[model samples]
Target: MYHKKMKSKVVRITCIGLSILTLAFVSILIYSFYGSKKTIQPDALLHQYMANINDGKYEEMYTLLSEQSQAIVSQEDFILKNQKIYEGIEGKNLTIKITKIDELGKTQILVSYDTYMDTLAGDISFSNEAYFTKNDNKEYRLLWQPQLIFPMLNPDDKVRVNTLKAERGDILDRNGEVIVGKGIASSIGLVPGKMSDSKELDIARVSELLDIPVDHINKALNATYVKDDTFVPLKKIPKDQQELEEALLEVPGIKISDIAVRVYPFGEKTSHLTGYIQNINAEELKKLKEQNYNANSIIGKSGLEKIFEDRIRAIDGYEIIVVDSSGEKKETLAKMSPKDGETLKLTIDAQIQSVLYDQFREDKSCSVAINPKTGEVLALVSTPTFDSNDFVLGMSTDKWNVLNADTNKPLFNRFKVALCPGSCFKPIIGAIGLTTEVIKPSDNYESSGLSWQKDGSWGEYKVTTLKEYGDQVNLQNALVYSDNIYFAKAALNIGGDLLAEQLTNIGFQETIPFELGMYPSSFSNTGTFDTEIQLADSGYGQAQILINPLHMASIYSAFVNDGNMIKPYLIYKESTVPEYWKEQVFTKEAAQIVRNDLIQVIENGTGSDAKIDSLTLAGKTGTAEIKQSKDDHEGTELGWFSLFTVDEHTENPILVITMVEDVKERGGSHYVIQKVKTVFEKR
Candidate 1:
């Protein structure tokens, strides 16, 4: 029995031993397959690191670092360092492309990657290598260092950024004369040691003269860095304010130094043309983001300064570099050279503009002067002008409000706008009548005192003239007498369709092709005359006709240019050539007939007051009434005078159109004619 039990025990032990071996073999196979999988590829580890960076998961990236790297940099320090450097340059769109994974041995790798990112300086791209190793747990890990962020980064290295300011451009006139140019402004300041016995009194006097506050001056003088010898600046005044400067110089302790400033030589005279510049606002920055404009940028506010902003503005440059502890540049990472703004030359005569402005200062008026022979614009002036320099030098809120609230509309730009042309449009009607042969130059008509109409169909409306001359009047005689009845009859005979067609062909109800914004001339609010009464009134320049003064100047040129109208241009280029706005707008015969009559109108008619001494001048006078109805006798009136020198009596061949509002009580068209005469006499 003992022998049999021993045999059974041996068999049992052998079977149990075999089962243990089978389980051990299966466990070995499973461990071998998973352990190999746990060892991450070098490229795969690099891709994961980059993905964490792209997601801004810097903590995860720190965990991917090798044990030696973790000891070198803490998780908090690593995250903060990466955050500061990347955000310092406004970096975005980070990408890392693993180009190659080199295996140094079984546990280490040298992975090369191409890094790219966009920043404020533009785009940055560079190639670098990432060192990686397997940790004790057999997982791949990065051997991190500061140099991993930037290939050139070292322990003491620093990223430096700087800006190169772009210089502003100048505004030049036709003769290369500086209009808006660089000049000096008096930097008003005081030396603490040089102050007189009455230091407080002197400072107070300066404050008043500069239109500055006493508190501001006191704060500047009391600044922490101020010394007895330091000249702490308080304010900047225009250099040309001689009287004010002299008064301030009389006060003790005041020291005036010259500082560079933007100058408008003509001051209030050219304010409407040059406009001004100011610091960019939040709304403007939002709209100009794609153009790289920032909060510190300066922008043109109005007029030509605003119109050609891109051409006139400076393009700033930038530099990204590495610097040492002492702030010395070690290497230039990226740099862009500054591009100075381009100077723009205009077809403007400074003298002419100044003279025209002087004449209209007291009155609400506007004028435009053009060189009829070359199509070059000479002058544009508006009355009650404000100083553009005030905008740059900083205007007080009270002063700005005064200008904004003025009844004369000093801020309004009237030169490029449309207004009633009055009798100044008579010559155009006569020219068109002769061109289409709708009315003959010699055709005579009978005048009916001061008022007349087509028939009973005209209802309460009647055509009226200031005066009648003879029983029978020819076209020239009617034009000379300023007869509205004669032209009204002619318009009735021509019919509305043909007259409207003729007006449209003459460039009416269309925008003038010019650089500046010119409101188009229109026949009426709805762009058409609804009745014969409306049509007749339009023919005599009294209905709903509104023409831009610039367009009017261009149109009148046709009468003198052998039926060709000169194209008005503002910008002056070296290769400029004279061009025509309209060729053959009238037959030579038609243009000549109207031209001769205009000369007569100046010589003996309503325009006689505008004739300059020793000059062969031709002109027309217009007084357009703004009334509710034809029978309404009381309303405001706009006075106009269109004049041109027919001969070389002046240095330049000039054509001017001057208009003044509220001339009804004043001499009507005669008032505007006198203003033109004064402007011409000044030349």
Candidate 2:
């Protein structure tokens, strides 16, 4: 009986143990199942969302979302946002492949699709990848924002937030006053796609309202809107009159958008330095697209604008609007706030620039002022200038043609393009003679009003003499009298190649690399000659050698700053990129010697016309020959003058270079000198 009881107990205990083991296994399985169900898988959501999108069931794809997601987004927004994608994939077979599944439960879907547009034809195709996430409810939805796919398209929903459109950074003078400002303008815009019936649109009404000819409006409308479905501007109407209001009311198809027009209050006075901005054209748009730039944006056309474009252009903000199948906005989904560009503080002094402009207006000439000590350009003035405001508002074709046709070439920046350095080249020769030891302070050559060739082939070239020095004149007197013979002798001693090399080192033969584009002036060697004729001509600033007025001014600056070769700069500071401002170039001694000699020229030589009372001035004058093919006055010379003045305290010297083309009508050097004197007198 005892043995039977023990066996029963053992059997019962074994049964209990097996039962416990089975229960533990079942519990583990239940826990695992629930845990997996609770976890949200973004990849699953992405797959489902992509599948729905491919099927054109935007509402179904949008509904599979968490409460937070649903509250933030709407069905109409989803449809509108995906409309562009659908359009892009229209008429082409699309293959959606899941490329990457990450630990965040997000899946990247690669969409291979083709598109057709007026600009792009022949079934253009490209592959784009997007990411999506799965919610806890086991629903998959797109995780990537719509902007990633259709960057140019509007968002589906409007974000309800007070957001400011950041303004582009101000262009300020050294004093921190705004050179370019925002103002309200009468803007005429047209929705090429929106205008259904061209007959219903009153071209006459638009012309009357905008104060333009009816024919002009009709032509623009036909050219821009007749064949394309896009927004095109007929013109930016000037708000100087009240007709804009009357036009907006009468023109049903015309829309007036508040546009921020850039204004230069100082007008033409700052035109050369500040440059101008204009609407992007088709060519510009194509280039911008290649550069990954916004199609509808303004860009710098010249001067500082071109130099600091990256720093001054603001990051454009975006609005998300949901659109429908027909490409109509339903609602806004999200928005990105724009950031303003950094302000640029230019080294330009408006006051000085104004003074220089007025000074050059007396004659059809241009001048450039550079800070010899630092290579900073103070003022660049090109006279006979047009209002830069014309460029800001998009100049009329008539005005552009007139400016282009003007004999003075008012559109040309004379300081950068026109070259006539004449006697101004003498200083460079002097420097070369001094540096090469070809002519010492003690060395003297006879200036009998002429220097003759050793071969006696060419008759002696006449040189003006202040005094008869018995066939011997020192460097001081040679410079003072502007003696061609003395310089010729010096040039022969130094050799033409060496002279060219020296002149090049002091800023000649190449374009002055300022913030503006410059034309490279010519420099040629006096064909390997045994005589000093070519050298003498080059020494007196003539012959095949040429240089721009701005370059001449910079070379003079090198003289004033004591031999420091500094690269001319216009921009002082940019908030966006600080690295550009850190560049330093120039030496002080080299600039000073040149400066001292220039001062002596103003005080005692040909540049005496430039002297101002109480100011220690230095200058040189040149009458450069212009070949006949250049203009009507082929034989007439261009007057050139460059000078720098030491203020009363002698702390900072101001350098200026002026070039007057075809100045023979006004007495060449004599006339130019008087103009320089007038400027100094005003100072």
Candidate 3:
């Protein structure tokens, strides 16, 4: 019985020994699997290394490299190389992916990856290969090489930016004439490096040929920053002046090239309408960067140039090139072609514009003419004009300052502002009286050379008529005689509030919807009449009233266009459909009656001096008084003549408005009459 019990104890000890052996085998397999995933696999090591690169963790990426790679590239060198490549790739997105991994040998692994990047050139994809070597500690490490960044990257490779310049579009007139264009011009200059003649003698000879001051030539040649290789421009010459160019070439150190310049065939005549372009300043660059503008770009500075900037601006292109460290070109990675801007065509009659400009050459005046039926602005003239080519070609600081300080205001656009309308506004009151049923066409009022009005709310005032018109006149005869006393009483009967509302409805104190900037017509009275004198004075266009020439011309255009005032436009591209007032400003019947009275004014009244042959003309004459000094009571006057003519051959009326300032000395109505007549006769 003792022997049997000992055998059972031996059996239990053997079972326990087998259980411990099985557990030991399972633990060894678990350890082997964990080590392979964490350190043995090349993909795991490569992924960790690339993660650091993606995060811009250069120092960490350097630590993951093999010992041999660390010997070849220092951490500082690695960081600098990567940073330069990253900076050159501006506006690009980068992403990385492990493509493939293969076991090469007992201690080496081949790793393949793809870099997907979005560059300005376009979406780009390329693959690269890396080898991870296992160290004595059984840890895999990445082998560093420049090709790891890009499959085609070389040790000496660098980046270069090439700008592809775009050509600006041309501006054309209605007759298909080139108003503004990129023309060939020669700049007379000297390359200091190539100059072998005496510096002083050469400068003297150059100054003589170019018709420039000797001091200017000396200053440019002796400038501190003027390098030996620098090309110093003395003056600009026309490319076609071969004789003058040959004469200048006799002087040593002279150089010339056919460079691009903004040329205007009719410079000063179309300056205000065509505008000009100039190199953008720092302040302008900041606001235009989003539009792909560069610091070296030129842009429109004023007038139509500023209004249609985007359409005329060029779209620049670029090329991404790979170069060596010494700035040697290696390969072109990507390229983009430049796109030229759209051509802009205008509705300007260059011949008519030139005539109007010639007539107003000596006077400080504003004149505008439009086709009443179509709202095609044929001519817009403002006197004391500046040569726009001066701004574009390059103006001296002194000359620019002189232009700004000129009393005549050569740079100021006169048609854009408001001025007193004088008796020219009488038609507006007549229209209001007729449309609002304030008076009938046959209504007559007793009038003399003068009349007086006294209001309880305001004070007493007097309105005097022109010496020509007598008493007891109807609307037609009153307009022909310009009877102020008659119109004043009519305005008082119509009330100021109604008159102000009518003016507002016709675009007073409101935007005129023109391409060029325009100031709104303005008046003080918004609601009710302050006094009968105020209404009467306003009715005659003498009570703090201001109206732009364009606005007045448009209003009268409605009278000729069957009570429809089409919006004025200059660009043909944007004016496909005619835009006019939604609500009619006058009835067709009222317009006809007013039109007949205007005809009488030209036929037998104040505007008779402006009569022309072969046409039935209609118009109004005005003389707005302006106090010379605020303290002085006596003032000069601004003479105005607004007229339109209709011929049997034409369906549209040719309308014009001319304003001549300081007209008392300049021959009031007669001066404006001759000016308008000269333009029409030229037409």
Candidate 4:
């Protein structure tokens, strides 16, 4: 009985231990099952997916989409769509922030997020909703929806982007008349593909009709990438030439096509001021690519047209269009309207510019007129100018080569650069002498047509006058006669450093604030006067000095405006403030004295030919000798005439300056003087 009782107790203990171990194992198994089955939060999945998209990881973004969405749109298509939208944007970034989350069902969640991107227009902001569903695999996936790509997109519609360019602005004159704008012209050419296979037949026919060499046509046809269908422009034909069009059409593959081209109604009259436009070159296109310029873009090549290019260029618009599979436009999704460029009004008087330009019909010369008080450039003309229309409408290679090879250099802007001022520089020196206390109006210097300093200080320092004066000459008579001896001796008294300071004070070697930049006029101001002869020569506008017509005219305006130099300008803007250097280069009294001397020039001195009837005029004449070389003492002459007269209507002094180069066959300064008078008489 005792043995049986002990065995029963052991059995009871073993059963209790096995029961405890079983309970522990079952608890662990239950915890593992619940942890593995927990659903992923919809908010977390949506945030991660948006983050991938913003990082430009479109491929990763595609992987997070539900199986339903991936079936319709492939990862490659999604990437391409994103790339097209971001192509032209400079620095692109997309910001997404979750604002709210709505629970639709036990496994579906809708997330609302704010989308933001900065664009040229401004900050572009919008709200979008992404739907997420817990898939059978127990992980949340983004449901493919129309709003997933863009807030306004639809499932069946295609996204298309169209670039719309604004119409380029019109360049207008002071009177608001269009000076440069769009117009139609004819381009004569043969479609390379349409031409006959026999080179001889096609080349001969084209050369005969266009007056081009057969060899030239053959060369052009054989150029690299000369496809058969490409239109190779042979020449620009006149739009009115219907007969020439018919004649050209008779040739196989030869045709006339109308193309939009820049038109300049005034043509050569405004060539220098308005400039011209041409197709962008490789180098220019590269530099302008960031500005949306392309290979086919027409850009300003010279003058103000180039200077104000950015302001005159139109803004480009864009459209989001939906197209069918065949690439046919089906519907417009969104559009941003294009804006035309603003109208640029200039300070130029077209009528006056036209009249002045015609006056120098065949002469190679330059003339500039300005309003002294207002600083308005009324007229600027560089004669022997080529018609801008030739470039705008297009020219043959033969005509272009001839113009460039011509010795006359009609393409050069003579008004921006030229030789010395000649006697027209007298007033500048006279003013310098009086202001520096070097000489007085009352002080008389000996002028017997020639003066020589025998002192060994200046080797071969001799001065001569335009004409013989009496034994003595004062400031008045020196200017009236333009006596070189009187002015030279006066310049020697001030020395080089002081004279240079005065020249700098009066706008010499300074940057003039004009759109069409001016070449800096140089002076012999190295702070070293090697010989008195150099100073003496400079006093008469000879020696090492170079001046442009624009700068010379601007300096003379100071004389007319009581020693104030106003900045010259071309464009007119209401917001543009007037700019001027007001330091007293010369006193009011000295300016009046110079004015009287100038008037005496027209009345009794070298510029007498410029005297106009019933017009009170103050003027000066100058003739400068340009040495053929350092050793060639006999030089060509450059004639100059500067005049200022008060306008009858405005009561402001109107200053006109004319310069003629290589005047060997001309009438000297008198020729320029008459040109000025002719311009004034028209007024």
Candidate 5:
């Protein structure tokens, strides 16, 4: 019985021991399961907050931390400081994922997370291992060891984004060929905050690599600052080789990014028409914001680009990434693809444009060639033009200064800016005289080289002429010879008020409303002129009359092609109708009489120089006096000749107009007519 009792006691003790062991195992299993189930622990949450802070998601990341953390860092302080850090991360994809959690004593936790980061500028992709420490209650958190962290958050990450870039739009010839588009150009970027620790960044070494001066690298490194534990750069990295290399020495921190540059292959050839784009400065930004534009972009400084900026700017896209304490990306939560700008096709013929550019290279001249029937501009040329490409990739400060200070004003689009109609105004006046019945087509007048006053006091109204031909000269002979007296007589008969009214009816004295602004040529209204001299001078295409080459071209188009004044247009078609205009302005018959007379001028008058062998052309020439100062008899003549071809075989007419300003030696209009002859012969 005693042995049996002792054995029973031993068995009970063994059972108790087994139960204790099983209970301990079960408790451990439960703890392990809870720990492995991804529970939101204080330390885990603190790590996430630190990651958020590093990634620049301060508010949400802050929320994840315990109340103690919030007390330690106020929302305002956190925002202000993290904004600097966040700026560094802008345009970068950063994400983090928790990989492990380790308890450190009773009050601290070490959390490890995996990170992935990408920078679009350098096409760089990086993966890193990171860790952060959190208090037991997840209240306060900090980077466990910043130096040991492979992917330390850079302070300059923010300032790098703020650096100015010259964003450019594509350049297309009138035919829609890509003359200039987005091109990749190598650039260097510096993270000021990243390089704040100058010891880690060897300026000389970097300068050697990038071919920049050591001083430059040192300057940039010194410019870095920390705000809310985030580093911000002070300046952009130098594009110089030494500077770029020195910046790269910091590797993942002092980054080198690529910039999109504007390119114009045609160079100076299409400069005037296409214009140029430039980076937006602070002042420009203010204006852009007022105009509802994106502040972080470039805008057309002049030419067609400025006129059509809305159609060419690319819509910005964004990506949402989750980052970790080590400033590495964990995942991409969402992405919005960028929308490319619309491609614009122009009506400008590159070949014709090149030809026209060459023609005016030696002189201060402007020309406008358009399809009279459609008002499609074929070639618009202005001399002393600059390469639109110079405006791209940030023109050197020296180059910019020279261009801006040039006396000739190469930047000005002389075709639209300088008004000098000269003899070109005659055809329009003739058309007015014919249409308004101010003078009959068969009306006759006599000229003795000059029109005189009844007193013959030297006629105070001597107009330079080619000498009188006969006693009775009709409109045909007068037009052929550009007889100043004949037109003067006609002007007297028609009256200045009536002439001005008629000219305005045909689209003069008003802004030539095209896609671009046209400089209005000066004009005046005079009724039945009592002064014979005023009437004669007006007849000879002088006396306060001025018009743009483009305007002159459009008006002349009306004269030749059945008199229907087609509104001059730039864009052939648009997806949507433009919002700022309406109505057409001139009659077909009115244009025909003018066209016939103009054709006769080309056939036999001063414009005879423009005659072509194969194409029957009609045109007129004018050399008007340019008034400089009172008592200073310095006469600078403006020459003009406009014509349209009468294709005998095709029965299709093509219009061309050429204007040359301030011709000192040969008659300006006469000189231009010779040029027209060359153009026609070539065509």
Candidate 6:
């Protein structure tokens, strides 16, 4: 009886325990399917909405709005407002963080967030609240408002931008005189009140004088801003166009007024150096949009204006204001003060520049003058140039077409370009020979006539010299005579490998140490001299040896500067000093030997035409043939003359190198020598 009672009690206890386990499993399944969703929906929906705003997806944001918010503001209006306020300020690099989410009620929630973005005016960071609500559809939606775009924004408020333009800096010379400065320009326009009875006749005459089309003037006259007494500006002309001003005044309806403009006082004389400013094109505007540039901004288009643009360009300031419906300022969101551009002073002498240009204005020529002792650039001139004022005021298509079609290439900049140096390069080889000790100053070579080849295997190839000065020639006589055969034999003595090594060590086929960009003086096109004939020809600057006009002048400084080439510069600073470009280029003894011979070259040799009674000069003259081969006769010739003042009495000593095209029948180097002599004598 006792065992049966114990078994019944155990069975009851087991049944009660199984019932409790079953109930717990059912409760967990209910929570997983429905309870958890209610807790996660609001936060996930809020996160997705915030992500949409950061990505600039305004349409998706509109879809996320609550029903009442959607009805109050239509989708199109919301999208436009978002796009304008976002893009108008040029916003970028956006980031948003949700700081907290709190429940206001079962259907409404308040979310705290921080927003940050970069704008054109400056950076913006703010904290705001996002209200989210659940509707009858049981889905969370945003409660949108103008405050969502900006915390302080309202329905009638406008995002206004105010720009304060900076004044462009002037470009000055070494003496602090302006090369480009603020000057007056004439505004050519029409006065409706002064129109004559024959208005068409007057308009046609004005149009012809100003080179503006008839339709352009008509459009300006018919503009909505035009009035019976208003001056309808048609075009701008140089202030000094007195002849045109007189002609236009005769046309009854024409009126002239003065306006401020960036003027080039030297006009075409310094156009290649100062360059010119013009309206910024589409490509430049797009590239510089981030720097506060607009369609109305003026930018440098060429020359120094283009090269040193960052230093001369103005820093335009901006203000972002919150304006009312009546266009009254309510608040300023961001502000920056206008900063003017900095001035650029150069080591240019305006007097020397003017002199060089005026002498070569009618010829295809290039000139570079520098202080050999200081390496300060005195003058740079390229002739047959177009006026920079034309570019500044305005340019007609016909005028541009004429300049482009001209065979002389007036638009091209010739200073930085490289050309064959001809016999003028003999001094460099002589210096190299002296440095290598392969050719002594008195070592003599038997003359091999005007032309000779290295060996019999080479056919129809020969190295030639201008004149055979002596039967037995040494280094000094070879340089003065520009004897190609002697240097050719000297180069053979140095061998092909050591000659190239020495040339490269002296900065051949390398970037010049100058602020201005220039093509390097190189030994050959392929960077190596392949044949003995080619190497021999290269010794006298014939076989693929080309040198920039500026660099050629710089190279001569080594002789006078204690065997160190001074680094050349254009822009001048107060603390700037003469720095060495290449040291130990030649021994001090070798330099003196070459220098003495150059003085004799001016006094008694080929360059005697450059002699003057009042001043002593040392120089070299060369005539380079632009032919396919040594004997090709149809090709044109280039005349070159490089000279420097050698006397101790000279005050402002200068080394001037000039080259002119098409001197074949015009006396060759003699023509250039006389021209250079005239320049010195005039000064």
- lDDT tens digits, residues 460-563, model 3? 34576666455557788878877777788888888777877877888888888788888888765454457666677777787767898888888887777667
lDDT of each: 0.84, 0.63, 0.79, 0.76, 0.62, 0.84
lDDT of 4: 0.76
Clashing pairs in 6: none
* TM-score of each candidate structure, all chains considered together: 0.84, 0.67, 0.81, 0.77, 0.67, 0.84
Give me the overall lDDT of model 5: 0.62
lDDT of 2 by residue, 1-683 (tens): 99999999999999999999999988889878875555435545545655665567777866754455566667676667566445432323333454554444243233333222211111322344444454454444554455434433334422222233556677888777777766666678665555546544566666555555667766776773365554556666446646656646455556666667877877787786677887677887786754424455777778777677788876665544446556666655345567787788877777778887876774567888766656667788888888877887767666788999998877777766747577677777776676666766667665555434545555544333234545557766666666666766677787877866666666555656666787766666433433455555666666566777766665555554445455677778543221221121223432345456667777887777667777888787777777644244548778877767754356545677788777877777777777666655664
User: Considering lDDT, which of the candidate structures 2 and 3 is the better prediction for this target?
Assistant: 3
For model 1, residues 120-201, the per-residue Cα lDDT tens digits are 6777889999998988777889999887878888767788667888866888888888888678888888888988998889
True-vs-predicted CA distance for residue 153, candidate 6, Å: 3.1
RMSD of 6: 7.4
Minimal lDDT window, size 10, model 2: 576-585
lDDT of 1: 0.84
lDDT of 5 by residue, 425-466 (tens): 666666677677666667776665654442475434355556
Worst 10 residues of 4 by lDDT: 83-92
Candidate 6 stretches greater than 4 Å from native: 1-56, 66-76, 99-112, 129-144, 187-206, 214-234, 245-260, 279-299, 446-472, 647-650
lDDT tens digits by residue: candidate 4, 1-683: 89999999999999998998899888889878865577667777777766665577778878888887788888888677655554433224667788999999888889988877643333456788988887777688988775665676565556666678787778887787778877778998777777666757767877877777887776777789678787777777657778878888877777688987668878888898888888889999989877767666778889877888888876677676556666777766456677777668887778778877887757778888887767778788888888888887767778899889988888988777746887888898888888777878898876545565636766554565657767658888888888877778778887888988888787677776787887777676564455667777888888876777777777777776777676788877665344665456787777778888899988888888878877888889888878854356667888888988843464545788888877766777777777778877777
Q: How well does candidate 4 score on lDDT at residue 292?
A: 64
Candidate scoring better on TM-score of 2 and 3 = 3
| Greater-lDDT candidate between 5 and 6 | 6
The residue-level lDDT of candidate 6 at 331 comes to 81
| lDDT score, candidate 3, position 477 | 83
lDDT (Cα, 0-100) at 598 in candidate 4: 92
